[model samples]
Target: METAYIKTPVGIARIEGDEHGVSVISIVDEATQLSPEIPNILSKAAQELHEYFEGERRDFSFALNPRGTDFQKAVWQELRDIPFGKTTSYMELSRKLGDVKAIRAVAAANGKNPLWIVVPCHRVIGSDGSLTGYAGGLWRKKWLLEHETPPVQHRLF
Candidate 1:
């Protein structure tokens, strides 16, 4: 596995992965350099993330290989299906997975998602339309949500 840290508008982001794909992308307070040998996967992920933050890209084009259990993988897959400018609730996701009772589990899986924005985990919210738990701080989640929303039109006076 290879690792590299990047600075973004929200915070420092740590990226880790290998030839399989990106396994983790998390926010932190400081940047850390990877070993002198840079893996192709980590380099690609970093480039894609840079494009994403620059608003020059919408969907991620790089491959992902997040590590998790079957259920967690399923939940992460569902999160990836969420469109860039949309949001869903834990209840909605639970229902989509065909088990409304699994809200807690679904939420836990969402919380454990390692791909962050690339996986679109920030699109999920509380049932009452409130921003809920995010591995990255809720403020960062809020900013991400706001950033994805379409620009409002204004009329000239």
Candidate 2:
């Protein structure tokens, strides 16, 4: 798999993929070297990610090939269905998966999502509407959510 690193507002993002598709996009906190040149296979993903961070794009159009179990894949697919700036609770996601009791399992799969922002696991929240847990970091999650949020409009009465 070809790998590349790019600087994002949150931190350095590591992108991995090949001809098949992009398999991973994750954040790294430790100091790491950025790619001198992005590979042809990963250039679109890198550019799309930059567009996402810049608020120029709402949805990703590149191919994704995240490696995971069937259940995890199902959960990740549902995550993509969530609107660009909307949030959903773990319970609600479990309900959508047709198994309310699988809340824990859904949460586990969400936590294991490898595509990061591409899969949008950060959009999942606690039932109480709290920014619960994120593999990247809660601060980063908050930043992502805030970044996606549409600006408030004022009415001049």
Candidate 3:
């Protein structure tokens, strides 16, 4: 897999993939420099990510190939169906996956998602509307949710 980095509002993002498709797009938790020469596939990912962070694009339209088990792949694909700015409880996700009893497993798969903004694992929240576990850190998760959410208008009565 070819890897490249790009600076995002929250942090440096590392994108990886080849002709097959994008395998991973993640925040570099250990810090990395942007690629001086970006590959074709990575360039498309970086551009879409930049647009996503800029709030100019709500959904991504690039090819993806996240590596995971069959169950995990199912979970990730379901995550993709989640609309931008919307939040789903782990229980709801588990139900969607056709097994509410697998909520914990569903949460586990969600946590293991390799593609960051592309997979949108951050959209999962607690049943009571509270933010929950995010591998990229809660702050970044909050930022992404806020970024996707439209501004709340105030009424001047």
Candidate 4:
């Protein structure tokens, strides 16, 4: 596996992956430098992330090989299906998973997502339409959600 650190508006992001695909994109409070060897997988993941941050890319088409339990993997896959510029509640996700009572478990799975923006974990919110716990921090989550929302055009000249 290869690793690299990328600086973004939210914070320092650590990317890890291999030929199979990117496995993780995590936020760290401190900045850390990566080794000089840049693997192809890491390089591509970094480039795609940069495009995403620049508002030039809406969808990620790269392969992902995130490591997690079966339930966690299921939750992550569901998260990826969430459309861009849209949000879903934890309860909603539980319902989709065929267990409306598993809200807490769904939230737990979301919190463990290792793919970050690639998996679109930030698109999940609280049941009452509030920004909830995010592994990358709530402020960053708010920024990501706002970034994905389409801009409102005004008629004023």
lDDT of 3 by residue, 18-124 (tens): 98889988888785777898898778788888898787988888889888999999999999999999989999999998999999999999999999988889999
**Which of the predicted structures, 1 or 2, would earn the higher lDDT when compared with the native?**
2
Models, CA RMSD each: 2.0, 1.0, 1.3, 1.5
Give the per-residue lDDT digits (tens) of candidate 2, residues 1-157: 9999999999999999989999999999999999999999999999999999998999999989899999999999999999999999999999999999999999999999999898899999998889999999999999999999967989979
Error of 3 at 28 (Å): 0.9
Ten consecutive residues with minimal summed lDDT in candidate 4?
A: 30-39
Candidate that would win on TM-score: 2
TM-score of each: 0.91, 0.97, 0.95, 0.93
User: Candidate 2 regions off by >4 Å?
Assistant: none
Candidate 1: Cα lDDT at 22: 86
Output the lDDT of residue 108, model 4.
93
Put down candidate 4 lDDT per residue, 29-68, tens digits, no spaces: 8657744556777887788888999999888888899999
TM-score of 2: 0.97
User: How good is model 4 by TM-score?
Assistant: 0.93
Error of 3 at 35 (Å): 1.0
